[model samples]
Every structure is written in structure tokens, then in C-alpha cells.
Target: MVRTIILALGLMLSVAAQAQEAKRADVEALLEASNMDAMIESIYAQTNKMFAGMGQQLGIKPDEQQLFDDYMNEVTSAMRKEVSWAKMKEPMVQIYLKHYSDKEIKDMLAFYQSETGQSMVKKMPAVTQDSMMLSQQMLQNFLPKIQVIAEDFNQKLQAHRQAK
Candidate 1:
């Protein structure tokens, strides 16, 4: 009788696990509708562009470009492997399920599959890139002002120390 009970419990657990897996798969489909995979891939291309500019800023020699490219490729490959859909699915599903119902998930899927949704997905990378450029420009403009403030503070500290 105990053996039969244990077997029944095992079957129940298996069914529960299958149900959880189905939910995760549903969540994954919703994420795919939003072009999550493409967004993740775009990170690699964006980083490569940033590295090219950084090389110039850091005075990296032309001869070292090949080495940088090789290393960047390997790093990007590792990141791609690490951030695969399987790894992302659990956390994303948890976040989605926490905040959304079955109806909401369906609603989101419908919206994301629409024309406006497609346009947003297509433009997101460029929008993000432009926003980053604007932020960098703003920081560049503010940096000299920050440096001047720091220099003035240092001089005041030196004068105060001498007076003491």
C-alpha cells in the first residue's frame, strides 16, 4: 500500500512539473512576440561599435585592432551562450506571471504582434543608441564645469590649511 502511495505521489509531482513547464513556455512565447531575442543580439553589435570608438579614444594602435576584434568576438560569443532563451525564460516568466494574468498575457501578445508593435520593435535599438549618444554629449559638456569646481575646492582647502 505504501509503495502504491509513493507511486501515486510521483505521478502527481510529474504532472505538476509539466504544468509549470507549460506556463514557462507560454511566457517564452509572449517574450518572443516582443522580439526579446533580437534585443539581446543587438547588444553585441552595439558593444562592438562602442569598442571601436573607445579604441580611438584610448589611442589603441591599428595593429591591435585584430587582437581587439578577436577578443571581442570571443566575449560576445560567451555572453550569447550565457544569455540564451532557456536561461532567460525562468526569470522573465516569474516577473511576467507575478504581474500578469492569462488574459493579460494574451492581450500583450496581441498588441506586440500588431503593426505599431512591430514598428516599436524595429525602432527600439536606434532610439536606445541615440539616447546614449545624447547622454554622453551632456556629460562631456558638464565635465569641464565639474573639473573647475574640484580645482577651486582643492585650492580653498590648501589655503585653509596654510592659514591654520
Candidate 2:
């Protein structure tokens, strides 16, 4: 009886492990089909562009442009290394595993392998870029109002601290 129980338990564990591995593979396939690596590259490019704009706005001297560019290049390189798809794939897989079930992942994989899904994947970078620009513009328009509110909050906090 004891040997039978042990054998059964081992079989169950093996089956569970196989299921997990299969799920992980499906999730990986989904990510690949979705072009997540390209998405990460797009994000890196956008970040580099944003940093370049900030450098220009900061009025780096013409002579210092090279220094600023070098610094920005280093920063972006570090970011790319840290956020590369190779580095991120496992964590991203874990996140998907946590949030999505095996069936859901399989469904997504099927969709991503389809023509419509491929089209969405191809256009995602542009859609993301436009959305980011719209959000940034909205934030810029709202920032002065936020600053005023923050200033008022600071004054109130100072008064409260003084009273205390």
C-alpha cells in the first residue's frame, strides 16, 4: 500500500509539472506571436526620444551637446539592457501565468496567430505612440493647474505643521 501511494503521488507530480511546462510554452508562444519584443523596442525608442527632447529643452550648450548625448546614450543603453525582452521574458511569463489560465492563454495564442491578430500586432506600436503623445499633451495642459493645487496644499501643510 505504501509503495502504491508513493508511486501515485510521483505520477501526479509528474503530470502537474508537465502541465505547467505546457502552459509556460503556450504563454511564450503567445508573447512571441504578439510581438512583445518589438513592443519593448518601441518603448525603448520612445524613451530615448523623450530624453533627447528633455535634453534640448534643458538648453545644453552646443559644446556640451556631445556630453549630453553621451550621457543620454549611456542611460538608454542601461535601460535597454535592464528591460530587454530576454531579461524580461521569464518575469513576464510568470505574470501571465498568475493572471491568465491555461485555456485563456491558449485562446490568446490562437487569436494572435490569426490574420486580425497579426494586423493588431503590427499596428500596436503606432497606436501606442499616438496614445502616449495624446496623454503627454493632456498632461502638459493640466500641469499648471496641478502646480497651483500643489502650492496651495504645501501652504496648508506648512500652516498645520506650525500650529502643531
Candidate 3:
């Protein structure tokens, strides 16, 4: 009976593994069909634009061409290290299998291949740039307040330590 149960469990696991493999292939195809390369280009453009704007506002004028090169190089290197693309793939694949059927991802990929989708891909940089600008502004506005809080907290800590 134990041997029979073990065989049955192994079969169940094999079937589940096959299903997962199919789902993973479908998710990877969907991700690739979404024009990931173009999306990455847009992201780089957005980053450059954001940094340029921030540089102007912050009044730090380095050589533009060298700055661009260095920035892009640093970003590329960081992405290769930080993203852990293989690990990231798992959660995304799970989400796809959970929320999106293979048919849905296929349809979405089809939509992304359309003219409107292409336009969206083109225009996303500006939207992303604006968001970065907003974030920079918020950080600029909040830094002083954050510093004050930190100072206050430090004072309290010091007082507590002295009492102790």
C-alpha cells in the first residue's frame, strides 16, 4: 500500500510539473511578445531625460555626452546585477497563470503589436519622466523635514542613553 501511494504521488507531481512547464512557456512568450526590448529602450530614454532635468534643477552641469555614457553604463550594469531576471520570472509566471490564461496573454501580446500599442510604447517615456520629476520634487521638498525628524530622534536617543 505504501509503495502504491508513493507511485501515485510521484505521478501527481509529474503532472503538476508538466502543467507548470506549459504555463511558464506561455508566460515567457507573452513577456517577449510584449516587445520587452523596445520597453527597455524607453526606460533608458526616460532615465536619461529624468537625470538631465534633475541635473539642470540641481545646477550640476557635467559634460553632457560623458554624463550620458556613464549614466547609461551604470544603469546597464546595475540592471544586470539587481534585477535577478531568472528569479523575477517565477513570480510573474505565477501571476500570469493565476490571473491570466494563456489565451489572455496571447491577446494582450496581439494588442501590443497594434499601432496604438506602439504609440503607447513610444509615449511611455514622457509619462515615466514626469513621474520621476514629481518624485524628485517631493524628495527636495521633504529632505529638510526628514532631517529635522532624524535630529529630534537622535536627541531623544542621546537623552535616554545619558539617563541610563
Candidate 4:
């Protein structure tokens, strides 16, 4: 009876191991269909564009612009080194596995391999960039309102403190 129990336990463990391997394989297939490298490269490209504007935003003088550019180059290089598919894949896969079932993962893989999915992947960077620009513009428009609210809050706080 003990031997039978041991054999049953061993079989269950083997099945569990195989299920994990299958899950990982599904995750990898999903990643491949999503063209993860292109996604990472798009992010880096957007970062470069953002960094290009930082000097102007900070009002850096012409004389110091070269220095700013050099610093930005170093920053970009560091980001490129850190943000590769290889570095991100394991953590991303773990997150997916935690949240998604094997069937769900397979569905995702199928969707990403579709033509519409390919188009979305191709356009995602531009969509993100435009959305970011719109968000920044909205924030700029709201800045004065935010400042007024803060000032009003401060005055009320000061009045309360004096009363206390």
C-alpha cells in the first residue's frame, strides 16, 4: 500500500511538471506572436524622442546643449542595456501565468497572430506617442487651475492654524 501511494504521488508530480512546461511554452508562443522585440524597440525609440525634448523643456542654454545631449546618450545607452526582451521575458511570463489560464494564454497567442493584431502592434507606438502628447497638453492646460486650488487650500490651512 505504501509503494502504491508513493507511485501515485510521483505520477502526480510528473504531471504537474509537464503542465508547468506547457504553460511556459504557451507564454513563449504568445510573446513571439506579439513581436516583443519590436515592442521594446518602439519604447526605446519613444524614449529617445522624449529625451530629445528635455533640453528645451529645461531651457538649457545653447552652450550646454551638447553636454545635455551627451548625458542623454549615456542615459539612453543604459536603458537599452537594461530593457531587452531577454531581461523582461521571464518576469512577464510569470505575470501572465499567474493571471491567465492555459486556454486563455492560447487564445491570446491566436489573437496576436492574427492580421488585426499585427496591425495593432505596428501602430501601437504612434498611438502611445499621440496619447502622451495629448495628456501633456491637457496637463498644461490644467496647471493654472491646479495652482489656484493649491493656493486656496494653503490659505484655508493658514487661517485654521492661526485660529488654533
- Which candidate number maximizes lDDT? 2
- Candidate 2 lDDT over 54-156, as tens digits, reads 8778999999999999999999889888888899999999999999999899999999999999999999999999999999999999999999999999999
Per-residue lDDT of candidate 4, residues 13-123 (tens digit): 999999999999999888888888787888898889888988999999999999999999999988888878789999999999999999999888888989998888788
| Candidate 1 segments exceeding 4 Å error | 1-25, 156-164
Clashing pairs in 2: none
lDDT of 3 by residue, 1-164 (tens): 99999999999999999977877787777666565555566665666566556656666556565776576678766875665455466676778889987678777777767888767766776777788779989999999999999999999999999999
Q: State candidate 4's TM-score.
A: 0.90
lDDT tens digits by residue: candidate 1, 22-98: 76677778798888878877776787777667767877788988887787688777877897766887788899978
In terms of lDDT, the poorest run of 10 residues in model 1 is 19-28
Worst 10 residues of 2 by lDDT: 48-57
Give the root-mean-square deviation of each candidate in angstroms: 4.4, 1.9, 5.9, 1.6
Better of 1 and 3 by lDDT: 1
TM-score of 1: 0.69
- Checking candidate 3 for backbone clashes, the offending pairs are none
Local distance difference test, candidate 4: 0.91
Output the lDDT of residue 148, model 2.
99
Give lDDT for model 1: 0.83
Q: Which stretches of candidate 2 lie over 4 Å from their true place?
A: 154-164
